[model samples]
Target: MGRMVPAKAAFAGLCSSLVGIGLARFAYTPLIPVLIGAAWFSPGQAAYLGAANLAGYLAGALLTQRIAARVPVRPVLRGMMLLVGVAFLACAIRLPFAWFFAWRFAAGFAGGVIMILAAPAVLASTPAALRGRVGGFIFTGVGLGVAASGTLVPLLLEAGIAATWCVLGALSLVLTALCWRSWPDAGVAPATRRAPPARSSLAARAVVLEYGLNAVGVVPHMVFLVDFVARGLGRGIEAGAGFWVLYGFAAIAGPMATGWVGDRAGFGTALRLGFVVQAAAVILPILTTGTLPLAVSCIVMGAFTPGIVPLVLGRLHEFAAGDPAQQRALWGAATASFALFQAAVAYGLSFLFAQTGGAYAPLFAVAAAALALALAVDVVARAIGARQVRTRRSVAA
Candidate 1:
């Protein structure tokens, strides 16, 4: 029984993330065309509806820490999961544009709250040696949810759209029930008694900036990769969905692989390498439209999408010197930054897509540029941090 406690807590966190982000957000991607084809919403309206989720995500990220401060972590996590299931069910019926928008937003908000609170809640109680592995496992839920959507959403669509949403809602509820008793009784509030080191603060800020830019970098693939494959390349929805499946499969490997690497090579090294590889992947589509190239792009981008989260989380843990309170505060700030950039870039890309008569290439080009900038920022920040360390040692001598 004692041996299983940490595993159970990790499983609970995974369920929260799976429902919060995996199903709540990615499930809507493949459904974009269905919503349009069925005359449920115009293309423009459908695009904006996706953006609404990001907007709500931003709101949720900004508020999660504050909410947790006032409430216990376990119930907040469970309630957010319940809210997401409810949102999925609410989205089943084709109501007014406002109705769908609001539900998507609510679902997104729940996802943000879950994303902010879940893993940290588990990690606080995790043994130090296992933090990376457990953190990686917790985030696997996002990929599992993504993979399930890619394969399951299509099968569910056969029964019709409304039924599909209802099924997703049902699955979420079932997972929630299974994990209801698994959460650790840890509070998420950061301690106000001590400030983090000045150098750590600087490094954390640099990492946060990089993470926000990464959010911009991923928007192209996250929001439009399916549509690009489906319509831009003249492939049908099934083919586009095949790419999403490839993405999902790659995503499944991303977190675990990266976490293993972080546990050995250091999170900073893993993250820097990831930025380079993902930047290349993001740009591959613009350079070529060949079958091999697109597949490679999808796989690489998919792996890094959720993979990078664990690396960042692990890195923040390092920066905080394993202080849970400081780690929680830094992570909350990082999430809000990511949410802000993701929402802004999502809306900006949607507008650009419309303005350019649905051009997809330029959007990817812009994303690649954002990633390149992120890599440069990380390098400069690391250099400065290293210099500060050397100087401090010299003065002490």
Candidate 2:
């Protein structure tokens, strides 16, 4: 029973992570078009702000290694919650685009730190058997957050964009308070790195590639889907918002409901399945381009990518290398790579979307093709990684 207590605490921490990182932070993607319209920022300027946010995210992820070396995970996670709230409020106040960029940048860092930190605690604390399911529920917070933001922002926009900002900022604060109330207060792990050979081994590189492929496979859903539903479907803002709601809810369902299956079935297989589903879903928008197709595709996208995050993180435990401090630095680098891939795909699609006036079939087809490509690459990488791990074990024996 005493042993079960940390698991319970970790679950609470997971909730905090969802609110800070998943809900407050990730919701920005779906809100991207709307924010540009409201702030009168150029698409280029918006892109810059988005990049700035990713940069901060990179910094936070990198720093988690140092923080974890000194403190336990839960306290660090709790502190991040409050800081994330402040940063969200900073964005809500509508700073100059430059300052807003900085604040969003900071928010990204805090969010990355919070989510990354939560994983180690969950990993260390969760029973290996149950880890995947709990991971799914924890990850569900992202979809829930995305869905909440998607649904909340549009509803508030109906009242005015200012109202929308206030609502998001306020929700973050509430989450911060909830975090403080529920857990020990500390920042994330400290920064540290391991010295291996100057270059990474093939296995590390493979892990990075697999993560990057996952990012590419999901980019269209991240960047273009909202506009696709709005402009392509001839829906108003309400309908556009509803499309995100569907997407976010589906994302939540993917990780939350099916996470256990991934744990039992294996993340690699789960990932392949997710990629196939996403490929099929992206095709839906291409073929039908109707409200129903759009909604279904959103659900499919959510299932594939959302499950990928927790699964990858969970698998990190399999070949634990370096000090725990260095482990997070490794993971953060991988995350930065993931974010970089997403950014490139985002602006690329935006350019394409503009060229076509959101014709969408090309984009959806391209996205499906990307996911298939990723899925193929992952198959090769995972096979090699598995073989190498088995070889090392045989040598040790």
Candidate 3:
């Protein structure tokens, strides 16, 4: 579209994601192996800790939405960003499991608030036509954060986990400060005060289903990829870190490419392509242990996992049109649904992983199947959209 979204505003949105999602959420993936190696927790306990974050995220999504109904979003967003940094600092205290869980949970909660608000804020500032590209650029912060974690965390691991936690927290505050002034002060529009429709249409329902399925499909990699690569593949921690870095790089690329495709072809088309590739990528490590396949798998998985979110959110944004209130509600519901599925899978798969004697193949199989199902649902949604367009044209004629 016209010049894409503004560079300064888009970069601020990216930094919000960097602190909220990249540092708060995805940073845990590479840290999973370290937590195991340090004996702060066993694999199963560590999984629970991770699950706790998702649980908090789900709760935060619901709570944030409820609060937004009554209060302004910008203040909440700023408060959440501060909380994210504080949560990270609290994690460095090295308390009991319950305490650690609470801190992580709080971080996830803050992260949830940031995720729900940041996209809407950024999209609201930009032209409707440029939302897709702006969304892509915003998510690149996640990839950058992931890449930073992959690269920086390992180096920081040399300093010990406590130190690492403090450092990460400090970095989060710095990023938060940088983006502090960027959020819009305009409160929720008066029109947004009226509640959204009681029932969603079939297309909206299908979109929610697709979003949930994608969440399930991502679990194997998010929680277990480094573990699978290091322990399962017998590659050791460094190789796993290398794969993580590859994934981070790919994550950055995937969203940008998807944005370009969405701008030209359509968001639906970009999503379909991403799902197919991601499904294969999820299953690739199990298919062959060769270096090339594994690397390709890591890169593809990295790119599409976060890449899908912008596409999904873009479509949902379109559904809400100019209604800020509806957009907030939609984002909250979509994110909560995604977080619920992810939390369920995290807990369930941990138990399964323990029962299966740590074999990762089955998890990959499940992830691939979820992605396949998501693709199928997306296809149906696209068909319905096309049919609706045709009907409208006919009526107009």
Candidate 4:
């Protein structure tokens, strides 16, 4: 245990996640107007690309289970980074819509692998005493990535979208190389992970349901939040950039806050609170789009949403008995759920906005509804699990 804090694991995990998340997911929001203006994509195309990216992420998540089981996590993470670089470079070509979609999918797949892999690996490697702090710091890399992209993409948008993609790809590759070099090879444990729930259907359905509800709540923020500000709120690039910076910082803080809370209290409490925070965060900014309220919402969303899902992931370990491969699969599936929900929201709202002629408030209200539903589902699941634990205790007694 003392030897396990390999600098490589921490740096590689953080670097891989930053590039994967930044280049793949967070970049889309800022790139929206630029792509729309350049005539490279339509609203439909944008939504599809997001779905496709998540599909790719799902694939990567699946692939990671295999890769992590056979090979060391360090190399797998590095390879994903390089793959992301390729996908990023390919996006520079003013290819047909199909080609761009395919490239985006590949980026999503690679990025997903990095995100899914880095998250668990970071958490698993840390000593029990320091897990919360390290996890907080590792998760913050996502904010770092989001902040960088938000700030830099506008400058790139001033250039051509193609140039922007190329530079982003180049930057990711550089980071990947640096982190790969920094990473030390951690030992692999080849033993089969714990058997997943024997009641397969029940577990599967619960996970899917849990993930789906959470996804619906998040998509509005992830896909349309920035665009809402730019288009509906009438706040342009600076507002968009500033909003995301606030979000990124908040994301970095969220895991740390929750991690501490989890350490002090219980994981369930942290997760429930996180979902509540997410609902408020999305709703508050839409209700009041000024600097102050938006800033608060940004912090709220950033600190809460991104980290809560991982808390669910941790909970899965308790039920699944810490089976690494199965845990990875669950996370990959969750990411897909996240994307699909976002797509549904975007597509659904695109039509609604077209019809109703309302502001972002209505759409945000929809997101809030979704989060509320997710919280309900989570509360039910937590209650059931608690009951089961009590039953087993009673039987043993």
User: What lDDT is reached at residue 178 by model 1?
Assistant: 94
Better of 1 and 2 by TM-score: 1
The global C-alpha lDDT for each of the candidates, from Candidate 1 onward, is: 0.85, 0.67, 0.80, 0.69
Global CA lDDT computed for model 4: 0.69
1-397 per-residue lDDT for model 2 (tens digits): 1264354545565576566567556656656677778665777787787777777776777676666666667667767776666766666666577877877787777777776666655555456666677777667767767667666665666876556666676777776665554442322334444533312245455555667667776777776666666676677667776777777777777775566776778765766776777788878876776666777777778775676777766555443442344445556666766766766776677688789876677777777787788777777776876898899999999
Candidate 3 deviation (Cα RMSD): 2.7
> Which sections of candidate 2 miss by over 4 Å?
1-8, 29-47, 67-75, 158-163, 181-204, 290-292, 321-330, 355-358, 385-397
> After superposition, which runs of candidate 3 have C-alpha atoms over 4 Å from their true positions?
1-4, 32-45, 185-192, 198-200, 384-397
On lDDT, the candidate that comes out on top is 1
Q: What is candidate 3's lDDT per residue for 1-397, written digit by digit as tens?
A: 2564556667777888888888888777667778988888889778777878887888888887677766676667777888888988888887788988998899888888878888887787667667778888888888888788778887888998888888999998888788777765443332236547623356666777888889998888877887888899888978887787888888887767677677667776777877898898888878898999988888788887678878987777777766777777787788888988888887788889989999899999999999999899888877887898899999999
Candidate 4 local lDDT, 1-397, one digit each (tens): 1365666666666777778876677776677667887788987787688778777876776666666667677677777889888988988988789998888888888876776677666656555555555555566667676676677887887888888999889988888887766654333343256435533334444655666677667666665666677776788856776676777767766766766776556555666776687888878865666778877776777666556654655544444445555655666566666656655666787777778775567777887888888778777766786788899999999
Once model 2 is optimally superposed onto the true structure by TM-score, how far is the C-alpha of residue 288 displaced, in angstroms? 3.5
RMSD of candidates 1 onward, in order: 2.4, 3.9, 2.7, 3.4
Q: Judged by TM-score relative to the true structure, which candidate is superior, 2 or 4?
A: 4
In candidate 1 the C-alpha lDDT for residue 139 amounts to 87
Ranking by lDDT: 1, 3, 4, 2
- TM-scores, all candidates, are 0.93, 0.83, 0.91, 0.84
- Highest TM-score among the candidates is held by which one? 1
Give every collision pair in model 1.
none
Cα shift from native, residue 353, model 1 (Å)? 3.3
